[model samples]
Target: MKRLLYIITIAIFTVLIQNSCSKDFLEVESADKLYVDEYYNSESRIFEALVAAYDPLQWFDYAWGQYTHIGLVSDVMADDVYVGGADANDCIYLHRMFNYEALPTSVVSDLWTTFYSGVNRSNIVMQYMDNVQGISDDTKALYLAEAKVLRSFYYTWLWKLWGNIPYYETNLTYPYIADQNTADEVYQGIITTLEDAINNGGLPMKAGSGREGRVSLAMAYMLYAEVVMYQNDDSRLNQALKYMEEIIKSGQYDLVSNFAGLWEESGEWSQESIFEINYFSRNAVRSWSSPTTDGGSVYPKFIGIYNLAGSPDYDGGWGFEPVRADAYALYDDNDQRRDGGILNFAKYAEQTGATYQARYQDQGYFLKKYMARKDGNANHSADADLNYNNNFRVYRYAETLLNAAELIARGASGTGTAQSYLDKVRTRAGLNAISPSVENIIKERRLEFLGEGKRYWDLIRSGYAPTYLIPDGLYRTSTWTTSKKYLPIPQSEIDASAGTLTQNNY
Candidate 1:
């Protein structure tokens, strides 16, 4: 009887254990709980996280690919460049000195989300780096440095767009509200981050064999130099000039012979490129080309017009952003970039059998810089499949040379050598060089970096954005003030903070 009781007890215990195991198996883990802490313990996992951080930087809806919108929405609108008709108001407001209170939802949302997303990702990487093991100290430092530089880049955008922003160093673990930091404070933070990366050997002096998309020490310096120039602080400019000179003397990069090559499909990862947001044609890769299967490229969806004659022009998508006459007139007749970079609306209209006359009722031409060819389509009929591999050029060798020249000219010596820098850019564009003057340098910068999103900041730094009115009837330039230099803090951010954080003046 005792033996029989022992057998029954064993069976009962086995049944309970099996039942508990089954219950545990059925429980689901929450996705939100999965974070940097859970995955960044190994070198391979850390590398994977690093790649994920880069993903946001390459998205078209973000800064890397949405160059046209960012630039036009800020200040440099092309008279003929139109898509979705969103930029019409943007150009008008930007040129005519419209109030920040009047900005469209698209502009407000895109700028807000892109910058925050980039900052959040960078913060995650930085937060987890200390926990990662099995990676070499050099490799670990490089990854950390890259994150810092990228963070600074994103902050620079915030500082430029919304002058006062609540700075977040790492991901918040508890509910918190912070007020906007002053513009100078934000810039100083960026300077300190880049300088630290440079001193710690965190950035690559030159591109490694497989590290085409990564930022080098020289790129960090170039970005720092740009920030200093924008601030117009003499001491900062001198420091910026010193770094620029170092990059120029390094001999790691050069100007590509053909200017168009900088934007071509094949020209990506070129020697002249200091740092670029990498986009690939692979279906699994989240690139501009993989829109439906992944996310679509903004260049095709936003910039590409329906081809009228060739096999791919069926969709009657309206081009929205157009170039201004003033901008068009700035380019010389022989400027190779003028024809290659700016697209004429009438030509596109003639090809598509659409009404071209009223295309730019106010300004006259649309942008051609990022138009897709018929042969480059991935889906052939769908506008989403335009897979041209045009990498966004963030830092280039030519800009470095120009930075160095500008620094020397602006120094206390006041050597009046600004014209030489302006001439170098002009001579490259197949135009005659100009005399060294601040006006010439400003003009050169406008022409050189047109459509690359530098013009608005250039205007701000030169103290001309507030006063520079567009000739078109769309804008009156007098209304813009120093307050207009920074975008108002988004209402959503303020709402989230529930009045704890101060909002910028609208």
Candidate 2:
């Protein structure tokens, strides 16, 4: 089993999820102690600070009253999954988001703050690096590069979800007012920061086994690709393609031979993985009182089969983000992803005599990418559902190949041909190779990353959302429009901004 995340052992970092709208993480410290004066004087302490920076990554699931799994939330907004729960009111914000009805005072506000928390933590980590002593210059540079990567990653999420958002590298002071920038401004800033971190040249192409969860050169490149591609910054696309080619030529990663095996317990951190937002269950103390603890992921439990009975293959859960039957239908029967990416509960029940209490949006389909398997949370001490050993794979080599293919198809040349890259993924999926046209690349992504939450953003970045995100049956009556592209800023954030922050056109 994997070791517990170091953040879990540090109660000093437990006060991470601050209730303030300022995202006042700079204030997070021991009681009655000025930590800045006392800490970060040593290398060991600086490493702890670095791990603390990775903590908010786990918070998007349950740090606040209205939680959001970035993957599930993004999928719900797409055609692959539904905001499935006991009724229309359960995770009702997701339902609102699905129909393009989310308001300023919405649950997705938690997502905004969660990502900001990461930004704050990363900033704090960088501050620690500057103050730290007895550390090698190389180590300090590495830590700083990782911090920049993390900050840019969080900013990328904010930019995609809320185009107009506060941008800050240094922590905000009391009243915590950050300069609100337009989407293009935020885009430029994120790209600049990420580019510096990458070009500064300390990040590893692949983190060694001992540092599996840490940021790597490949992860930074992927984040770079995401931000530039999303902004449609054509000037940077060639550079982005070069980054993809770098990963491919390095030969440090490749697709796992067995497609379904990629999600199994043993498949984690395989050759295919570039980054994973980690979750742990061994000695987990993440109760409802401390959902932000370094424990298990709430995502698997949130989307697992609800009220499942006698399921030898899966565990029961709150039942949100049910996959669409039509999405499953689009897959070829011989495609391994059809079995690995989605859980056909109807077929399972018919074949094995298992059952579930079908709640809202019960199409008998579930996301298998991070599905809660049987006994997934059995080792946890409290709130079993809140803890499951599931790590969200942020980047995989398969995507590296796909990215190279897509970019090459769009006229960026590299070490490999577009057809070879596309063919590699297809042949691995037990399918024949097709031409590496941009359309084929897009369709392949829709298939390759079905429930992993790529469909929505893929549509958005490709300018396909307006037509591709059409109404789906009685569920999504509203088709996606340009105005609904960005989510509304949280009302609480706006109020705390003292009229400094502007809300999106939700």
Candidate 3:
């Protein structure tokens, strides 16, 4: 048990409980009143404000129809999996995203609102940090750094999803018309904020045991590099290379010997993890509550096997994001990632003499990375519907190595560093090391992180969407155009902006 205390008990900080769970693994409670003005006189109260900043990461507004909308669904929009569920109309927004048919509305709006909620909370926390008295400057700096990094993390999602967005560092007032900043402005803002946290904020290079869920200096370094790499600028790639090299040399992280073991409950916060979003079903008593009170991720429930006439190993779920047959075929038979990364229902049925019932767009496969397990440890939720304890590894050491390799291939120094990094990942996977190149790096990541939410963004950011996603059977849409590169600003947001916000050229 990680200190899930932050999720269950932080509600005492003047925020009434209900509404948003963590999207980045931060648990949330409703702020019945703006407590920042009245609550920061004590050190403990300051800590609560910091935790509140983390809340929007896991928000799931049931009334607003925002159900676990960030990480899992974001990946489904990519070319890796079909929008699997009850039917074609089920999660139709996601299906539209999958087919490049989504407009600026509902699902898009919900995601926008959720991330901005985080931005708002983070701003609140930072403002209140200044009013605290009797707390050590060091303590204040660390907490402030964590809040700033989290705010940047939220904006990274916004910038990546919608290129033009309103940017602000402090709380805003009524009529709330924030002029949209250019994508470059948003990127620069994220980079500057993280760099400040890294240089001035008192964050340690690594978090001590029992603190892996919190932001560390290493996570900030990783985020800095990831943001720069996404730009695909040769000079920035060189800058990213330096940050990655610093992390590698520090030896604070490494690849877990067993890749498959990384996803198991036992693997939570393993040595290979840099930043992991914590989730728990423990001490939770509801089968269904407003997301604000739920502590466990809904990922397992969303993608678990549904209606399987098999042994209890296949627990029932809503069966969303069915793995594509082509994706299963992408893995070599000997590769460890194949069996560990996916649930091959056909193969499971063959072995157990059980029936794998089909669902909407059923492709005979499902993501195994976060599926709910039958082991006794899973039912920590009293309601049983809320039972799932898996944590999401936001940044893993293996990704850092791959980033180094990709950067080197793009144009960086340190001879053989790229190949050395690639070899390490491949060698662990039971294969001979191939020479490092952009093509091979992309291929390796596709296999290594399937269903782990890396594939689609990897292709899109690398500018390969046209080639990798446009085929007839690859996605519902047979055509890919440059205009589809960035998602449009949510229609509601544009309307609310009253001309201050401009839509993307979709």
Q: List the residue pairs that clash in candidate 3.
A: 21-58, 21-59, 22-57, 22-58, 23-57, 23-58, 24-57, 104-491
TM-score for predicted model 2 compared with the true structure: 0.94
Off-target runs (Cα >4 Å) in candidate 3 are 1-5, 8-38, 60-63, 285-287, 375-383, 414-416
What TM-score quantifies how close candidate 1 is to the native fold? 0.80
For model 1, the run of ten residues with the poorest summed lDDT: 1-10
**In model 1, where do residues sit more than 4 Å from their true spots?**
1-38, 60-69, 76-107, 284-296, 310-317, 345-364, 377-388, 412-420, 474-479
Compare candidates 1 and 3 on lDDT and give the better one: 3
Better of 1 and 3 by TM-score: 3
- The 10-residue segment of model 2 with minimum total lDDT is 8-17
Clash number for every model?
27, 0, 8
Candidate lDDT scores, in order, read 0.60, 0.84, 0.76
**How high is the lDDT of residue 449 in model 3?**
79
Model 2 per-residue lDDT tens digits across residues 334-411? 999898888898788888888888879889888888889776776787788788988888898989889889888877
lDDT digits (tens) for residues 260-355 of candidate 1: 656666666676778766544333223344432222245533444433344243232234445666677777889977766675556655665554
What's each prediction's TM-score? 0.80, 0.94, 0.90
- The number of the candidate with the highest TM-score is 2
lDDT of 3 by residue, 244-339 (tens): 888788888888878778888788788788988777776654345455555666667777777766665656778788888888998878888888
Name the lDDT value of residue 392 in candidate 3.
Answer: 76
- By TM-score, the candidates rank as 2, 3, 1
